[model samples]
Target: MTKLISKTIALLILTSFSMLKSQSVKEILKQNGSFRKDTIFSIKSDSKETYLPVTIIKGKEKGPVFTIVAGIHGYEYPPIIAVQELLKEIEPENIKGSLIIIPIANVESFLKRVPFVNPLDQKNLNTAFPGLSNGTPTDQIAHLITKEIIPNSTIFLDIHGGDASEDLLPFVCYYNRKDTPENTKRAHELSVKLGIQYVVSYPYTLTSTEPAKYAFKEATQQGITALSIEAGKLGTVQKDNVDLIKTAVYNMLENSGNYAVKKSKTVNQKSTVLLNQQDYIRVPENGIFYSELKSGDKVKKNQILGYISDEFGNKKYDIVSQTTGIILYKVGTPPVNKGETLFCIGYNE
Candidate 1:
């Protein structure tokens, strides 16, 4: 009950974007422009701060307001690099709609070399949606994105992937929410149009931003056609993953009839595979995890995916597959904490 009250309070106390020093995104969109990119700071303290590096490209013709956000997890490097490539791929004259590109969302974590959480408050930026303005640093960043970015976005992509400790299968996923608005359908369609082959269907039960908890989910709740992509692995910037992200975004912009897309080395997969259910196996205790499986491995029901042992090397639990499916992502490293995700199985019925 206390937690519920706190959540409700946080929802109501969503402060305005007073932290922004430059013109707001909507204000920038109001003007016809060749292109404008700026860094909006989210101030934490006298000496601590983070920033959103945003690029705005308005088309000659009017269309959707597309927003691409990357680097929610600091260790996800490919998505960040992909956004830079997008800054080049998207031309103002050819774009029918405007493009808002955020190359790095968690700048502090990226700069500090933090893995999953922000170095400011040790909080996961991706999990905090519609955050409190007067709260922690992560919450402040979330609030900044929610207030400034989400409102100006008609279509959204929150790109993320494996952190420094995980192995992730490259795939794009759309929210599978019940009784969602038209945004849900459009999001799924766009995920298919991304042309990356594997499309995972993730279930989301929330309908509002306060409870959505994820960046893309918050946008989805706000009636924007939003989805996310998982690529890269173990905090390394793989060229293939970076290219995959760039090509996928280009395909989306091309399908939108807005941007001038260039054909290069991007090979579209022959067919799209629809994976269902976001089956994540999380550990319940602090232990050393052992898994030989990689992302995309097929697993049978009840099969031992891995085992968690204590510090003394005594096995405490065996991580097993609850459903038969393909692994979308898995912890590649051995460190396993309480309530940490071990594997996410993407199943098909």
Candidate 2:
């Protein structure tokens, strides 16, 4: 009788363990042809877990998996709004592949109205890609994105805009790889399909180091087709800019055969090749920068783009264009620091 009881107890324990495992394996977005929202925890504190919002939509028919991320800088409001609106409009039933949308990647920075870097760790999320698991809060977020989110994606899109202190034009960027010609070609096609005003290609030969540091660069290194879309300006959330970003995303979805929408005509825009660091103009000293040149303005080499003056207007430094190209973005804020970027010039190759 005792032996029989022991066998029954052992069976019950095994059954219980099986049940727990099954419960844990339940997919976050279990229903096909539907959408569900969840939280991806990047940091865990004593009291609560800091997480980013993740929306997963599984299609009825299996195809590719597209990952869309925004709000990396927190102050870029247009991309954040665009992704939020996209989550509402995409229907899983009409999609052919999975769609993962991270509307706001840095919630703490967004809530605090921080600009380029996270206030908690003072780290720029963009530069901390493929990050360390036990690093700072920003690093942990990057690590989660690189490991948990990006690995499941076949295509990746990172949306950005002019931060609180930047004024910029609409542009798209893609990584160019000589070793992976097919991936580079696909990324270029994706950039053109985005239908932005301008497209910039970052060649892999520019740096000899590992290319797994920047968000899009890291995705490209992982064999994922990735593109970065830039829109809006000065950190303001304009409805038109938001609509522009949303339309570009829809274009990609249609072009990729994931969304059952009207096919968008691919419009090829002018391409700007950034070959070196000299493409950017940096400030020489701390002062107040006054620039009349806005983004998209064409300027000649050695042209006076702006001028920096001391607080009392005593000493002044002239900012000039280093290359004969169109201004991609300029500083919107008045204050400047030594070695800070004042403007980025984009030229056709």
For lDDT, the strongest prediction is 1
- List, residue by residue over 1-349, the lDDT tens digit for candidate 1: 9999986764443223223456877888898656655545545644455556677888777888888899999889999888878777666877877888888888878978999899878899888897878888888888878898998898888999788998988999888766775777887788888768789887777745346778988887877788898889999999999989988887887776667655454657579889877687888799899888999889999898889999899999988888998888888988888988888888787
Check candidate 2 and list the clashing pairs: none
Q: lDDT tens digits, residues 1-349, model 2?
A: 9999986886675455334422110265445455544444536534333565666777878778888999998999999998888887777787887887888988778978999888777889999988878887878888878877787888899999999989998888888778888878887777776767677887675344463777878788777888899898998999988988988888888878788767444443545444222288888999999988798888898898879999998759888787888888889889999987889988865
RMSD of each: 7.8, 9.8
Model 1 RMSD in Å is: 7.8
For each candidate, give its TM-score against the true structure. 0.89, 0.86
Model 1 lDDT, residue 220, Cα: 78
* Pairs with backbone N, CA or C atoms under 3 Å apart (clashes), candidate 1: none
Error of 1 at 252 (Å): 0.6
Candidates in order have lDDT scores of 0.81, 0.79
